[model samples]
Target: EDQVTQSPEALRLQEGESSSLNCSYTVSGLRGLFWYRQDPGKGPEFLFTLYSAGEEKEKERLKATLTKKESFLHITAPKPEDSATYLCAVQATTNAGKSTFGDGTTLTVKP
Candidate 1:
């Protein structure tokens, strides 16, 4: 079975503070790992896709990294607008269209 776990269910950061969110997973065979940002009452927005260990992607103030067993979302000098729920998901080689998702980590960046 494929499984994902995100730490610090919720996070609070002051404007300009940088932090990293963790997503750990176990899968039969990794096909891909994904990261998303979701706002209240809205569907998640795609952030990054990583296909192999040591891979990484970046957008604006966010950076996503992948490892064999885990992934990280790094937020740099975040602003209030950066506050959102960050989700992690994984696709396994055995599951073509289905992905296992973590509950998500809600972030609050205050000015």
Candidate 2:
């Protein structure tokens, strides 16, 4: 079974405060890790695709890093507009099932 878990279901931060969220996973055969940002009532927007460990991707104030068993989303001095649900998904090599998503960590940046 491939499962993903995100920490701190909700986070509150000041406009310029930086923080990092964790995404942990357990799978029989790990194929890939995906990061996405989903705004209210909108579908998830792809952010990064990590194929192997020690790979990192960045865009603006957001950075994503992946490892063998987990991944991290580091927010650097986020603003109010950065507030949204950060989702993590994983594809397993063995099963042909759809990717499994984390419950998501909701971030709120106060201006």
Candidate 3:
């Protein structure tokens, strides 16, 4: 079975503080790993897609990295506007359209 776990259920950071969120997973065969940011009641917004180990993607102040068994979301000098729930999900080679998702890490960046 494919599984995903995100650490630090919640994180508190001051504006300009940089941090990284962890996403660990296990799958029969990795197809892709995804990162998303979700606001209070809105659906998650796509951030990155990693296809293989050592793959990485960046957008604005966020960077996503993938390894064989895990992924990381690095936030650089975040602002209050960066506060949101970050979700990690993975698709397995055996599962074409289904993905296993982690509960998510809620980040609150305060000024």
| Candidate 2 per-residue C-alpha lDDT over 13-104 given as tens digits, one digit per residue, 9 for 90 to 100 | 99999999999999787888999999999999999988888999999999999888899999999999999999999998886567999999
lDDT of 1: 0.96
Off by over 4 Å in 2: none
Pairwise lDDT winner, candidates 2 and 3: 3
Q: Which stretches of candidate 3 lie over 4 Å from their true place?
A: none
lDDT of 3 by residue, 6-85 (tens): 99899999999999999999999999999999999899999999999999899999999999999999999999999999
- lDDT for 24 (candidate 2): 97
Among residues 3 or more apart in sequence or in different chains, the pairs in candidate 1 whose N, CA or C atoms overlap within 3 Å are none
Model 1 regions lying over 4 Å from their true place: none
- Residue 101 in model 1: shift from native, Å? 0.4
TM-score of each: 0.98, 0.95, 0.98
RMSD of 1: 0.5
Residue pairs whose backbone atoms clash in candidate 2: none
Local distance difference test, per candidate? 0.96, 0.93, 0.96
